[model samples]
Target: MALSVREQIADNSRIDILSAAARCFMDRGYAAASIDEVARSLGATKGRIYHHFPSKADLFAAVFRHGMDLNYEAVRPFIDLPGSALPRWRRMAMSHVLLMIDTKPFQRAVWIGVEMHLRGATTPEQRSVFNELIEYRHNYGMLFRNTLLQGREEGVFRFDDLSITNQLMFMTLNSPIFWYTPRVGETRSDVEGVAKKVVEYALGGLSKRREEGV
Candidate 1:
């Protein structure tokens, strides 16, 4: 259904707030991030953010959730595709790599949120929100875990331990965020080419057949 004008405006503001907040967290660590900083970045007042979120933790949580949603949006279609899981997994990997590059700030916020959780830097309330995100992340991981199991059953991929292999796959796929930056004149094709290389490298580490032929 189409959004009404009021709802559209509200949604737009929410997205703008999330984008600005993501950058705020990226520019300053979460411990140092504030709604005022986010509002200043948006050239608005803290009241503008409070209209949508009650606290900095909630705003940060919303940003993290939005980032996860972007990843799901990027790869869910490929996950639902018919036929072999192995090939679909490659597409999923490529889709995720592209998202990491395209949405680096949001993705970086994701990593920062994880760090906050690990350091126990968040309050009880923040921890509550982070826990929900943790569950959401687990659910997302399960999607890929199912695909890996399918590929293994079909003898399409080889791995000794499912959990270790899954973690390794993600470390490789998510590593681009640590080092990638868009070239001065980069195009969609250029990004895709980089994503393709990352996926191929990931596959090569996990399965010989993928690098050799698939």
Candidate 2:
């Protein structure tokens, strides 16, 4: 199938707008961001943005969804690899942390959205998109849950309650968002090291104690 120039231009324009919207939303929280500013950032006109997204809310949702999609894609490969749960968890943590550092705009947009949702920013479409994103987020949680179950079955992990343990593991893995910062001297490798340490601490608690006890 051959593509037309007009179609390619349209697709590129949409991507540019979304990228610009992401940056603008990150720099100036979504509530404070204006479509005009995003359009100007993209060297675009408001009409171009409207051509792609009918409303400001719609554009925000699109940017948020795009970020979620990127997260899903980044973590998807490691979810089901053949390994102990701990190793997989470590990989997921490092992957996510590095992603937060590398994909600044996406990460910032996500954090902004999180704050907004916590503050009751709920319209019908926004609510629907948020619910869907929450469900999508469950994919990562499910990986942790299944990994815990697997480790338990293998007698490697001993937890009293699978549900609570899974939740706790996810909570620990997600801490990077709260505390991580890439300063002038900090490197991605540094973040990865921290992620590994976090995974180690979490897995250590979950692992069964040896009978001989050190």
Candidate 3:
């Protein structure tokens, strides 16, 4: 269902707070991030943040959810496309990598949120929210996993371990967030070109060789 007008405004304000908070977390560690800092980054006051989120952890959780939602929305279109699973999977992977490059702040927040979880920085309440986001991330991962399984069934891809291979594929796709920077003259097409090349490299590892004629 569509959001009502008031709900839409509230969501927009919430996203504004989340973006500011994400930048704060991205610049400093999440544990070091403070609501005051996020407010300053947004040129707003702490009350503005508190108006939306009750705590820093809640704001962080919102950022994590926002980042995950962006990923899901970006690649969700290609997940169920008809035709060979390999091609559909490639498009999804490419779209994901492109989003990681384009949406650096939110994607970085995602990595930082994972780091926070690993370091035991979250309270029980925050952990609850994080766990829910984790489930969403798992659902997103399952789309690729299912596609990989289908490709394997068709003899289009070769992998020894399904679970490990799925994780490896995502790791490879997510790695660009660590080192990628947009060039001075680069366009979205240029970024997609690079993303496509990266996807091809990863897919090539799993695909059967044309010469083998599977």
Candidate 4:
């Protein structure tokens, strides 16, 4: 069913809050990003944010979830196509990199959540949220993990450890969120160029068969 008018307004307000919070967290690390800053970015009061989110950590978690949703949407088409694993994986990985560049702020917020969890810096409530996010992440990783298995079985790929290779693959695909900055006169072509390079670099690491060239 479509959202009621009041529900639609509430949803829009929440999305605005999340978008501002994501950009705030991206430009400033979690330690420095505050609810007040997000509010300021939105040109609204902190109460507006608190009305939707109980705390800063909660807002961050919401952003992380939104980021993951974007990621799933980006590659799902490629993952679902009926074809050889090699081409499917290539398309998925390329789309992943393009998303990292297109939605840099949200993607960076994802990395910040990982860092906060690793450092044991999150509150008890935040830790619970992180645990749920980690499970989502694991499930997401398994999509690629399963593809790698298919590729290996077909003698089209080489890898000793699926988990490690999956991590390495993401590290390459996700690196653009860290190092990529839009040039002053950047265009869609520029973004595509960067994603193509990143996709090839990641595919290279998989060590596929000679006939199935990157």
- The lDDT for every candidate, in the order shown, is 0.88, 0.75, 0.85, 0.88
Ordered by TM-score, highest first, the candidates read 1, 4, 3, 2
lDDT of 1 by residue, 1-214 (tens): 9999999999999999999999898889787999999999999999999999998888989999999999999888887888888889988998899899888888899999888788888888677788889788768877898788888788777888988998888888998888998899999898899889899888876775634664
lDDT of 3 by residue, 1-214 (tens): 9999999998888888888887788888777899999998888889999998888877888888889999999988998899888789888998899988877788899988777777877788677888787788788888787889889999889999988888788888888888888889998788888888789878987887888785
Q: Which residue pairs of candidate 4 clash?
A: none
Clashing pairs in 2: none
Q: Give the top-scoring candidate (TM-score).
A: 1
TM-score of 1: 0.93
Worst 10 residues of 2 by lDDT: 170-179
- Candidate 2 lDDT by residue in tens digits, 106-163: 6678767767777878786678777776676666566566767777777778888877
Q: What TM-score would each prediction reach against the true structure?
A: 0.93, 0.76, 0.90, 0.92
Off by over 4 Å in 4: 209-214
lDDT comparison, 1 vs 3, better candidate: 1
